[model samples]
Target: MTRISQTTRLEKVEHIVGSGSGLLDFAVKGENGYDTWEGNEDADWTVEDVDSVQNVEEDRYIMYPEGDYFICEIEADTEERNSGPVRCWCE
Candidate 1:
């Protein structure tokens, strides 16, 4: 017979909004999944990875690892809105 054991790690991070048009940026290279919130829901928002920044859209984004790690950046049309703490974890 064989036995296996596994463990999970959780990491939480909060990012404050500065002088920008409600833009939030962060890198998620070693996390399993993450969620972002605290922004204008009506305003035009776009979410993109480090590879794509010029794209635009209107939606909320929650990121998950799909075999590769990536840095996500979100931009909103409104400003002065702070991004709440983001929670991420790995299992």
Candidate 2:
């Protein structure tokens, strides 16, 4: 079995609004037939992989199970309330 970990920084977060509130949906790719986990307390989030096989390509993923996560910022709604670019590096 190969252990591969991936992380992705959300793009277009500025265009993604907070709906007059301070929240947004964040997404990450996972592998199918594998168990995955997520948390907000880590500097870099981690997920567990338990797959017999794996395959991945650019700009797409196949997570056996699909889910959604959230991020709540303290910024208010304004023209200048846009956030800076997010950077992600995975190995």
Q: For candidate 2, report its TM-score.
A: 0.17
Model 2: pairs clashing at backbone N, Cα or C within 3 Å? 32-64
Q: How high is the lDDT of residue 29 in model 1?
A: 36
User: How close is every model to the real structure, measured as TM-score?
Assistant: 0.24, 0.17
lDDT of 1: 0.30
* Residue-wise C-alpha lDDT for candidate 1, range 1-91, written one tens digit per residue: 1111112222322211211243333333343333323343333433223222232345323343322443233332223353322222222
lDDT of 2 by residue, 27-55 (tens): 33342232112222222232222122123
Which residue pairs show backbone clashes in model 1? Answer: none
Assess the local accuracy of residue 82 in candidate 2 as a C-alpha lDDT between 0 and 100. 30
Cα displacement (angstroms), candidate 2, residue 81, comes to 13
Name the weakest run of 10 consecutive residues (lDDT summed) in model 2: 11-20
